[model samples]
Target: MGFSSRTFLVAPDDTLWRLSTSKFDRMLRDPASHSLPTFARQRARMASVVVELVASEPMRVMRTTYSVLAFDAEGRLDPSRFEEQQFALVESVVAPVIASSAEENNQPVVDATARFIAQGGRWTPSPALARAIDEAALEQRPCGRL
Candidate 1:
């Protein structure tokens, strides 16, 4: 069996502890606001568990899978349905964090993050992204620096 993962580059001023703490705190303070039918208050509490698991680790890996609706028994792609699902994930989960971080740091809006998925669910970053990751690695600050 194979699995896929997405790695987020933590900026110099950010730490997994800080990010996790902030997220946990925010969810705690506004449970009603963050709650969704699929992600209710109990589901939100799982964030603390995840934070605990990764606190002492520099990098944590989690498995993720994409959702697709099957309109046919043969499992063919439905472009419109697929696009709608992807856009919803991006808009609801991905965009807000990216936009907020950009705004906080006074960075330009990132129209897209390029992704190349190879056979067996491998991810290959573009040259520019690879360079950025390398640069970010060099700039990692001491834990709790910010």
Candidate 2:
């Protein structure tokens, strides 16, 4: 089990914007002019998507989805097996990541509920991961099945 983390720029409205480690470091050193899309939660629509985050991503997705739950080989919900090949999605609930400005690419990315991609090996939870799970559910990004 291992822990992975990425830096993000949080918006005033509590939206998390992706930030690269290198970029974050550079931003700390130099405040350059940059612009990001304004996330209008009210305007963003929801769509259901299958998230399958594996240690090795077979394809690239323009949008990212996060899932917090995983099922074991026996189809049992195992909190510890999220990092394994345990993956599934609820078709009824729609993920809350689709928006007007989110059409940058046509690729697919599966953060596997945003929780399954914790590590390449066994899945383990950290304080940050725990919080991320909660946020994923609230946003309906890819977990909790609504």
Candidate 3:
């Protein structure tokens, strides 16, 4: 399938804000440039990676409900083939940011995923493809940490 054709959802636990508060639109609008929102920053990094991996196609999303849909090259979702794309997206985009920031904290992203999987986190692709497709916008922004 073409790059933009498949749709996926962002896990609630993996929300970008949960990764960093400095990312809060509210925070960005204000004057006090405080410490980087570490979680948000890291998550934002991961989110950027995901978009890059799933590049080229346009993604439509609903913000309030956080629903996302990507038009597959074939215009359909193949359940068996979905996870590879999902994992790759997660690994490519999200992992580096996780590696970059929380690398110091030693936060267990893989562990978290393992736990989620252990808890029966099925591979149901979300209709919402996890908004924030602008990797350029995000990558251009400086990370608080190296």
User: Which stretches in model 1 have alpha-carbon errors above 4 Å?
Assistant: 1-61, 73-75, 94-146
The list of candidate 2 runs beyond 4 A from truth reads 33-146
Worst 10 residues of 3 by lDDT: 62-71
Rank list by TM-score: 2, 1, 3
Each candidate structure's TM-score, on Cα atoms with residue i matched to residue i, is 0.23, 0.25, 0.20
Q: In model 2, what lDDT does residue 107 have? A: 47
Model 3 ranges off by over 4 Å: 1-78, 106-146
Q: What would the per-residue lDDT of candidate 3 be over residues 1-146, giving only the tens digit for each residue?
A: 12222222233353332223233332324314422323231212223222222364433322221222222333232223334444544555556676668768877555455334322323332333332333222343222221
- In model 3, the Cα lDDT at residue 15 comes to 32
Best by TM-score: 2
Q: Model 3, residue 28: displacement in angstroms?
A: 39
Model 2 lDDT tens row, 1-146: 22234333333344544444454344334323222224222221121122233463322222333333332333233334332422323311223354222445664544445333332322333456435543452343433211
Which of the two candidates, 1 or 3, achieves a greater TM-score against the reference?
1
Candidate 1 per-residue lDDT over residues 38-94, each given as its tens digit: 221110111111111233442432332323222232222233543554565556566
